[model samples]
Target: MSERSFEGKAVLVTGGSRGIGAAVARRFGSLGAHVAVGYRSGRDAAEALCAEIGAAGGTAVAVAGDVAVPAQAQAMVGRAHDAFGRLDVLVNAAGVGPYLPLAEIDEAHCRAIFDTNVLGTIMLTQAAAPLLPSPGGRIVHFASRLAFNPLPTSSVYSASKAAVVTLVHGFARELGPRGITVNAVAPGVIETDMTADILRERGEQILAATPLRRIGQPDDVAGVVTFLASADAGWVTGRTIIADGGLN
Candidate 1:
């Protein structure tokens, strides 16, 4: 394992049933990595993805867990580690982003957003830090371009992702000595099931604002996530690579 080829590496991707997380999982599977497709309620979709990866000559399995729960978070990591015998990468793509005006923000809304986006990320990293290989451990969290440039009704959601960026900064410093790299990929409006409404309502506005003149796809962000997990990005940490086609 001196060279640490991308093949045979074990990767756990939370919220991987559909959307950006699914794209990241598929990317790793295509690279010959053993993928743990972690999902909350989309068991069927997760299992389907696993089958797809397997059909394509890669290894994958669907693991169910709610990342916001500390016990569940720990179990998710443990499950992936037990399955592969060694964990090399952890991608915390489990998150929620529901835009609400400040006046409409309720305790439940705040809790739901932060519990998944902020706390889930921290809990997963905490569980993964010890198991990940020292020289090759990789952790990538899902942040958002809104964290830096918030939209009108995105206060709570934006704040949650902002917390992810700060976590990367703190975790990168703490985990550097062990040779693990922690980073975030803050993607712009990626076309996914979760963002279908936003796309339908604000399609024109978003397109005009985006330099690329098109909404981002999951694979677009997946590429950046895989790079951050690769040996090529060993020296990169504590940074949020905004994958917005230069929207930020």
Candidate 2:
């Protein structure tokens, strides 16, 4: 695809302050899309990313909001539209890790994971649907390798991601008539802060399981997302593109 394939488009990435979210935001911005970086915290990191994009001559704005809340999710979409006049793509990349056993999973942990990973995706998609132009719009959600095969202490996180995959299918079906595509990327063992602790502890085990013998990175998944968001993926929708380094 041309470097300017996404030029004149508007893209929004939630939880884009750091890690995978940050990478996704930058990738889209670099493609000439007016990007919106949505964050719940890490104001400094968010601001720095926006500045970096600006310095690179990419259009970007950092918007702070919690995805778990409906109002906040709406606000994120609103801000993206307000900034760029339209929203051509919405990427739900905001997520949290809760690596506890099923027995140890409490109400709070379950609620938090579900609210942000599931409900937040729905709310954000709904808010951006109208802004998506007919015949060319995309919605990408983040899933995990654990959705296919869960680890011992990651039941909650795995379940939440599984829900995301399910939502992707349903949304794609619902939006197909309008020419909107919905999909997901299931990444494995990315080198990010959220999994820093896990990597330090189980890096070897993960590497051994992955056929590539390496952990995935934010850009590894971001590349796939960028593809799904582009015109090249016009016929792709309601699909989960797994980027797990052959771990599963």
lDDT, candidates in the order shown: 0.92, 0.91
lDDT of 2: 0.91
Pairs of residues at least 3 apart in sequence or in different chains that clash in candidate 1: none
**Which run of 10 residues does model 2 get worst, by summed lDDT?**
97-106
Runs with alpha carbons beyond 4 Å of true place in candidate 1: 1-5
Model 1: per-residue lDDT, tens digit, 70-184? 8999999999999989999999999998888889999999999988898899899999999999978999999999999998999899999999999999999999999999999
Candidate closest to the true structure, highest TM-score: 2
Total clashing pairs in model 2: 0
How close is each model in CA RMSD to the real structure? 2.0, 0.9
**C-alpha RMSD in Å of predicted model 1 compared with the true structure:** 2.0
